[model samples]
Target: MDLHYTDAQNAFRQEVRTWLAGNVPAKRLPSFDTEEGFEAHRAWERKLKEGNWGMVTWPKEYGGRGCDLIEWLIFEEEYFAANAPGRVSQNGIFLLGPTLMEYGTDAQKARYLPAMASGDEIWAQAWSEPGAGSDMAAIRTKAVREGDTYVINGQKIWSSRAVFADWCFGLFRTDPDSARHKGLSMILLPLNSPGVTIRPIAQLDGDPGFAEIFFDDVRVPSENLLGPEHGGWGVAMATAGFERGLMLRSPARFQRTAEKLLALYRENEDTASPATRAAVTQAWMDAQAYCYSTYMTASKLMNGGAVGPETSCNKVFWSELDRAMHRAALSLSGAAAELDAPWLDGYMFSLAGPIYAGANEIQRNIVAERVLGMPRG
Candidate 1:
């Protein structure tokens, strides 16, 4: 139950803080309102890569610092604090990286990991077909195996960043006979492959972060297969576990956000309404809980303990907390929370927190059944 960081960890935090102070550019924060903001984020990601601070937790063999998880957490804190940029390669870095580390061939790792680590190749997740959504086992995209290649043909909806990314990794039906979770295979495909088309899905915030991808006889090299054929379900679950769980946003990041919200609250003497006060207080408490939860998780990971359903709970908690905080901010701002409002855009964008990274409801189910030992429906 030790929640305190060691002296060495504090030093690591200072080091990250110093580097970010010098390197973080003075750019306006990104807005979900326009494509320009998204491009700015990508540019910032390139800057981070050039600075050699991207993917700090990955092994040095993959162009990372190979730092411990605590150091990674510290770095994330500083990154968010600097308001640097939202991760443009998050799906690739968080979901696919660990999966490749676990199941990819040496050549596959050599081919993809370095470029991904360096942010030279951004990636998107090609999961969640229109019919699939939460029931990922129901994905209908088919990949028929040909000699030395797999010709893929299907439409993937809600494929985040596919419109701008270079690669996508996901499950495809390699065996027509396979039903439910069986007969699926995890494959990596280049987004620029012939016959592939991407159409953006405009969100309420007016950003095209999600896109629909059509694979019309698109062919990928057979060498891109990860793990065993018909064994993609396991690989996908592992990838999702990392994606929806711990690797993307760490606790310190949440702590910094919460602190910012608290500062906002403190600066407003008009936020004296009982409800607003209570909401702000609750947000602060939730932020601390998120920090503690991440601390425990980082400790466990450092001790060689694997992340399981517990990370699902953390994801749900922190994401919902973020939404709550932003909601409170809107409430505090009252009439200024509408479109063209000062706080309107950010508050609206925060609304998507619960929906991304495996919707909060699904995370709750994972926590209830897999982590809490509750019986399934």
Candidate 2:
């Protein structure tokens, strides 16, 4: 792989660095899981949109600067470096927006993409029903077609950001005769629909970072459907690819964490155990490896190659690396790590890295079965 950044890439990095230096909030916003914090994050997203920096890979008509994937990666590097407010609109901008771009109708694109870019309609994911957490094939939510609308009825649990989101997208069974991965359709619906109910679930810190959603014969316009009916399994997998493989966890995030880990180690090396120092060194190396892996993936995509099994490998690598990095930071922090600081917050959030996108066990299975060509039991 080419290790050198082109002159244009360097110039773009400087541009992003300069803009972020000027624009990032001086004080950190509250956690976006809270009501006030949610609005605060949305405002930050709007500020990013105004700067034409929200999801830079999006087309220009969608309020982006039409940057390529590498530029998006560079932007992410600068963003986390600035200690910018966390992306409250990520469920839309990172996960659903890419899916919509691939499978949405012209009208759907015009309707959702711009609002998503502007953070006017923040989105939550409505996957992981009571039965189908990792086994998406087990999803029981159904959306029955009724003329110009689909009447949806089911329960969705562990929906991230649902407590405050304006909309959601997920795979619902439209064909009663079908089960497992088959006969599913991807649908988008407003959170305030007449027959919908939302109950928030608190995180370790008591913030409602997730919610449970109940659909009681909720009706969404048939036009809201994305991709082919009964073919949503593929569409959802495509979305999963983006989630597990790309946007949900970016390399810059881990790189920043690694830098913090090194700084922590340097400050506490006198008292830190020998093992902790070794782990810190390993974390930095892993972060660099992840950054390179992601760069290779971006290069492939930029050159018209699809992200496949290797991205699953990337997911496993970075997620575990994030947890390890946080562990090292916590160890370096000694007793102070117990306090409510960035290290504590990051450590808590890192605990979920292996679970989000998809559970690491399942991802390892994918690596074994798909990448290594090992036979499945």
lDDT tens string, model 1, 210-249? 8999999999989999999989999998987886667876
The estimated TM-scores of all candidates read: 0.94, 0.98
Candidate 1 global CA lDDT score: 0.81
lDDT of each: 0.81, 0.90
Instruction: Give the residue spans of candidate 1 off by over 4 A.
Output: 1-4, 29-35
Backbone clash tally for model 1? 0
Pairs that clash in candidate 1 = none
TM-score, candidate 2, is 0.98
List residue ranges in candidate 2 displaced over 4 A: none
User: lDDT per residue, candidate 2, 1-377, as tens digits?
Assistant: 67787999999999999988998989989999999999999999989888888889999888777888898899999888989888999989998999999999888998999999999999999989989998889999999998999999999998999999999999899998998989999999999999999999999888999999999999999998999999999999899999988887788898888888888888887898999989988988988888887888888899999989767887788878888888788878878888989888887888888888789999999999999999999
Per candidate, the number of residue pairs that clash is: 0, 0
